[model samples]
Target chain A: MSGIELKNVTKRYKENKFEITALENVSVQVKAGEFVAIVGPSGSGKSTFLSIAGALLKPTEGSIMINNQNITDFDEKQLSSVRLNQIGFILQTANLIPYLTVLDQLLIVKKMQGTVTKEDKAFALELLKDLGLENKEKKYPNECSGGERQRVAIARSFMNDPDIILADEPTSSLDTDRGHEVVQQMAEQVKTRNKAAIMVTHDERMLSYCDRVYRIVDGKLSEEVRTQEV
Target chain B: MGLALKELLYSKGRFIMIGLIIVLISWLVFILSGLGTGLSTLSTGVLSEAEYSGIVLEEGSEFSLSKSSVNRSLTEKVSEQEGVTDTTPMSIFRNSVRKEGAEDAEDKITDIVLIGLEPDSFMEPNIIKGEAWSNSDENQVIADESLENDGYKIGDTVVLDNTDKELTIVGFTENKTLYHQSALYLPMENFQNLRPSSPDDADVEETVSGIVVQGTDVNLETFLEDEENVEYGTKEETIEGIPGYVAENATIMLMLWFLMIISAFILGVFFYVLTNQKTNQFGVLKAIGGSNGFIIRSVISQVFILSLVSILVGIGLTYLTVLALPESMPFYLESNMVIIYSLVLLAISVLSSLFSVAKITKIDPLTALGRAE
Candidate 1:
């Protein structure tokens, strides 16, 4: 109830009177201290579902609840507030701002929230240290490797202590070993911090790090076998 | 503000390059404006400094003092009219003056404008040194301060062109130049002797070029209508009628405004392209909870900072150029005018950034999720 809940969510796109459904009546609940992975092939609407879950995109008909508050009727400004204070996103391609340093990547969230304090700075530093990027804090995104950039992105997501973490193919650009390490770190953060997480990925190797997995085929979502213990 | 400044610092080369372009454009604008001011003062300084309400010229002279010929009798009639305090006849003509011992050669002649007026009249200049006009002596004259630049001093003898008459400089006054030429003040008798007689006016009495009047209560329209072959206008309008005055000012102003608009367009195009390149980054920021206001503020702050610094640098450079320029150069920049132009540049910069702000507001954060079509 304190995490993210989606009920009968349907997303449809209309282009010149031609309607195409991207999500079809998907119902899922991600609880606190849980790591869920949704896996599907290309064009399976995996990204669309994650986008809707993250509140970046709205569904045509459905109700989304975060912390037991329905957000389906929220305006753009209110939705932005929800995204800012409640949702953390780890996007594909490691979208760290090219102009910011590794430490600034995390601090920007506090700046946006207009609550940057000494404690926030300390927590950002601690988050970088926990992610094993303590020494690379002063380095820009272009100066870091792909894996390092992903780790920095992960640190940025945890900066605000959000209620839910949404990651879309966060490890798609990493090697096997680095990808597995990043997913393991993400899972550890979810369980340790008691935050809910939903990862949309196509890489089957990442499923072993999640408590549960879901498979999406042709805009339909179904629960899969548990690959790891919670 | 921090993010905007950090980005500017991060991309030093690109921002500085754009900033330098602004500096160049601003520098040119400031210099052109200074030149425009200088040329305006040079063209109209004499008329502007006169303590008169109106000038009466002969009809059909197009307000040109050189082409006008007012009968000397009109002065008494104008002075006795209602609300007319005083009326003085004056003559202005361009002539060459040579130092006493100079050979008779064109190269030795210094071009000057000779103004003929009544001694002790309202048109007499306040003498800075030496004595004022004592009588209608044909051999004594007062020279303006600019004559000092040509090495002419009080008591120095100079020969007026076409008269074979030498005159001694008896006094010097300040701010008395006409048409950018040094002025020589002469008595009315000397002016009558030197003024050319028109072949068509063989039977006419002695005529003056124009009449300078004081006191403004008279009806100028009815007065001019009553007198044949006479037209009148305020001193300011008469100054504006000077040849090349309006056109010169207009051309310089047009150039200055064109530069300003082109600078704004350059900034707009630059920021637009920059925002286009960073659309994906903006999308990501929006998805991560950055509001439209925050993004817009950052973009505008960046432009403001860049414009403020670049314009200051350009103004500083212009000041340096002004300081290094020779006294002979006609370049005058007023401090208030500089401030006004700087504010205009800053405003233009903010307006230019609107293009980028619009792009930012329209960016869909969903694009950041990498959702396939």
Candidate 2:
């Protein structure tokens, strides 16, 4: 009951007068400790679905629920609060602020919540240690490797300990070995934290670690069962 | 604890450029303001040395002390009016004089304003070097201390041009200047002896350029309002009435206003450009639950800190530069004016950062969703 549930969500974009359907009645349920992967080609509503579930965008016609409360109709302030307390996003390319060190990157999330306490610092350090970034706390983003930077972003996303984590192409910028390390860390953090999570990726090789796989083609979604060894 | 401060520290080179601009602007403003105050004070130094209820002049004399040749007997009539404490008849003349031992060339001639007043009145300047020039003393003058810098010592003979009246410098008074020239105080009998006629060309009856009034302002104003021949001016109006005083002050004041506005615009543009460069960071912050309020406060706080530090440094620089200047330079900075203007600059600099705040408010976190680098 305390997980993200999207019920028949549809998103439309009106560009200059043309009403283009971006998503057609998409429904997905991601439960606690579940890592769901969304696979799609170019222009297949992957970003649109991730945006709506992450509270970055509102569906044109649908109700999105988190902990049994419909957040689709929430105002801007309420939506921002939900984003802060319930959802965490790991975007592509890490997106670490250039000025902040790795440790400050995680603490900044808590700072936005209100004030960062000593307990928050310990929690941030624990999260970084879980992601194997204990020594990189004082290092800036540019000083870290691509895989290490992505791992720092993962730790930052989990710093708030939200119920659900959403990642959009979390490994697009990493190479074969670093990409595996990044995605594996994302999966391990989700499982160890018992948080429901969703990742939208086009890389077929990264799908083996997922519990379930869903494919979207031309704004339509269909679940595909696959045999994989985690 | 502020993100703004951390970022400003991390990017010291970038913030220093804007800070430098602000410092230079504040420096220029302080210098101009000091000179403006200096110029105005230059024309009113003599007025500042005395306390007065009002300066009573002829009604149509345009406040020019020279144009007001009121009857010397008018002082008696005003002294009898209610609220009148005392009255003194005064005359003034701009004369060139030579020190007894100095060359008599045009270059050696010094400009001095001779003020012939009743030695017993309150208008008498405090004698510093020697004794006061009493009415009984013949050709005894108390020269301003500035004449000392010009090599005229106390007890030296000062000869007035086109006249046989040779005044012996009896004493020296400090900081008494008339229309930016040294004031030489003399007894009325000795001063009138040096002049062929009254400068205002009054009738043969005893005439005076103006009356120094020492009483309540309301009484002087109301009483003068009924008198057809005379009017009253408070200290401030008397200073403003000096020729070219209002225009010079106005021109400098206009420049100060425009400089403040221009500096604000420059600060606004600088902040706007920096904010635009950091849009990616702001978007990522908003995506990860950073509120717009937090970001706006960060921007404003950065502007406030930078502006405050820069203005303080500029004020320090002004004080240092003032120490290096010669005493003759007519530059003065009033404490109140400095405080008021510094606050205005700080306010404008902070207000200008609203430009960056507006840009931050419009940034959508969605831009951070599918972007790289």
Candidate 3:
């Protein structure tokens, strides 16, 4: 209840006056301490569901609740506030700002709301140390490897202490070993910090870190029974 | 502010290049403004800096103060006119002078312009050294300080060409020039006696070239309408009548305005392109809960700091350049003009970044939703 919930959310785009549904009646509840993975092929409405769930886009129908507050009727500015205070996002390929240092990458999350206090800086540094980014705080994103940059992005997502962490293919830019390391860090942070996390990834090898897996075919969403490898 | 400062510091090369261009542009702006102000002051400071508003010249002389001559008694009549505050009968004579005991080779060494007005009148330039003129009957002169560069010194006796009359330099003054030639201040009675071309039969004490008139333009014009062989002009109009003043001022000011316009456009486009280059980053910031207000503030802070620093440096450069120039150049830069131009340049530069702010507002955080890192 203190995480993110989407109730029968549907998103449609009007293409040349003909409606194309990107998502249809998808209901998902990611509670505190849960790591959920939504996997599907390209153009399978995975991004639309995540965009709605993160409050970056509004659904044509149905409501979203974050920390038990309904966000469906919220305006654009209100939605942005929800994104800032309640949601944390880790986009594909680390999506780190090139000009910012690793530590600033984390602190910028706190800076967006107001002045970043000393405690906020200590917390950011602690998060970096916890994620194995010690001695890399002053280094820029370009100076770090793809795996290290992705880890910084993970640390940045958790910097605001948001209730829900949304990651869209965070490991897509890394190789197998580094990709596994980045997802492992994300899952470890979710369970240890008691934060809800939803990662949308196509790489099946990374699904081992998720507590629940949901598959999307076309615009429909349904849960897949947690299965073992062949 | 944190993000803005971080980005500016992180990308020093790009912003420095842009900042350097701004520095040069603002430098040019300040230089041009200084030159424009310098030329105007050089041409018209004798009139504008004086307390009186206008002058009366003989009508047939066509606003040429040198050729105009009038009855000194008209000073009293002009003072009685409506709205007239005061009047001083004055004379301007173009002359060449030499210091006493100079050899023939040094003859005509200084082109001396003599301005004849009452010693304590509004037309008298405040002397920076030596004594003010004390007698209307005795020969006394307050030479411009520029004369020092030409080897003329205070208390030295000056001898005019074609005549043996000696006018002793009594003091030195600053910023007095007419028709691009430095002037020496002297009393009206002595100017009448010492003029080289005066006819022997003329009453030197009863004649003047013009009257320095102080009053509202309307009353002056009305007084002029009723008068014969004379016309009235405000100080600004009198300045325009100075040879080469208007034409030189127009060209320099035209270029100054054009430079400002171009600088504004260049600065605006630079910021716009800068914002365009980072629209993806801005989008990402928005996506992860960074609001438009935060992003706008960052962009504004970046632009304001760059402009402020660049303009300040430019002004400093301008002052340095002014100091490096020779003293003979007509280059006078006032503190007020510097302040005004700096503020204008700073404001336009900051305003230029608003286009980028507008672009920032339109950036959809949804573009940040799944952007490839």
Candidate 4:
């Protein structure tokens, strides 16, 4: 099960000229199979919080327990291994390697981890099929539309069968309809797979699709535990 | 593995440009190295394949074969050494020769290095046609094949300039020419009498320009310098003593080595720019669990592939040039030389790629996720 527990996490950017507190004493937990959306305006440190949670950036002080193991004390290699084996990150941009075909994109990540099994290919195909991109596996990122590229990015995120998926502005560049569809697809997948999903977004209109929504303003998070009754 | 290759294939323009740069650089190195070897062979044709281990020249002497000289008595002294199997007197002088019966001759005289060798000398290994020289007044000369190409037959009488002596070409040898001029071989006694040079006022018969000694037991060179007051040298030392051998080789080698360094810098710069452009992707990969070693291996593999392709193309082009070269152009293609040069080129290419690694290793993976255009 992919459950994330953050207790008293704080992060600060200390430069030679100035210091900026990005996240201050932030504590949160998301159960497995939860679709959590982190909403914030610009400079609200939502990216910082999501980055710390994804093990992309280590917190200045805190323990990140994912599936009961504390990841904050892990070394660089260990952290990378954690990210590879246990976490999947999706960014605002699709960030697909232009040179790799859609099928090869997932294959490369798997190859980087060491070897790709027959089952891995089957699961990749199944993921692509679920994302409505089964036909575009041989195409390159440059040949795909924005929405399709996003979907491929999402598919790549789950290629390793990660327990936790962290998405930062996954549909920031898409139209309202495409953004809504991308969020809806991600929500449906998170619930269907029973995997925890934490998304950082500035788009308020997309928050309704998530199981829970939280807002960050001025280095603090304000949680909103509500169900969509519509 | 597949992704790295796919990346290279996708960006045809960038990789091709890099490959083209590699090809052009490698081609330049190959051509220059070939020319350097060709010129070196040309300068040392007579001695490169000689049987003598050493040529005894005067100590502190700059010129060994070309300008160094010793007396006939000195040749006898060199022969007296324990290792001395035999010693032959050789006299070299430059003079123009003209065919005696050429009616259309507008002074059709060609300057040649007349090598007065013994009839039984060990140095005459490549005599292609006709017999060696003999003690005769009828003027017997073994001309290099180049002279034969210039229209001199075995029976053709060549009039030595500044003398009434006319020599008949008795034979021809291949690649025996020194520098750019053809060499003519004659008997020690005849070459002394026939080849046009300033007469030795003192002990004329005993005076000889140099001596080729065969055998290895004794240091005949020390004996030549001390006892006979003559210069001596080993074959390798003699080669270094040849005019323009060391200087020319040093200049060419310096240029080649410098070009290799430049290749490193060029590759370094190319990879630096490339890695800089892909910093964001690198960060994204790093964020998603790509280790630094993985990134490094991928970049290095790309460079290795590029260098390998370029070197192959460069060597192929060099082979074509060497093959297409005119036989008389003095360009020689030695297999050992090719191997050595290619290894050197490859070493330079690999060294050049290190600059890329140096730049890549310094790249902060965190920069990949930071504000990128």
lDDT (tens digit, per residue) of candidate 2 on A146-209: 8998999899999888999999898899898888888898899999999999999999989888
DockQ of each model vs. true complex: 0.55, 0.72, 0.69, 0.52
Name the runs in model 1 displaced over 4 angstroms. Answer: A15-18, A227-230, B48-91, B116-156, B164-176, B185-235, B323-329, B371-373
Model 3 misplacement above 4 A = A14-19, A227-230, B53-88, B98-112, B128-138, B150-170, B196-204, B210-234, B241-243
In candidate 3, list every pair of residues with a backbone clash: none
After superposition, which runs of candidate 2 have C-alpha atoms over 4 Å from their true positions?
B48-53, B71-91, B116-157, B164-176, B185-208, B212-221, B326-328
lDDT-based ranking: 1, 2, 3, 4
Candidate 4 residue-wise lDDT at B69: 65
Residue-wise lDDT of candidate 3 within A59-142, one digit each (tens)? 999899999999999988999998888899898877789989898888888889888899999999999998999999999888
What DockQ score does model 1 reach against the true complex?
0.55
Better by lDDT, candidate 3 or 1: 1
Clashing pairs in 4: B55-B233, B56-B231, B56-B232, B57-B231, B57-B232, B58-B231, B264-B352
Q: Give the lowest summed-lDDT range of ten residues in model 3 chain B.
A: B216-225
lDDT of each: 0.86, 0.86, 0.85, 0.78
Scored by lDDT, model 4 comes in at: 0.78
Candidate 1 chain A lDDT trough over 10 residues, lowest sum: A221-230
Model 2 chain A: lowest-lDDT 10 consecutive positions: A221-230
iRMSD, per candidate, in listed order:
2.0, 1.0, 1.1, 1.8
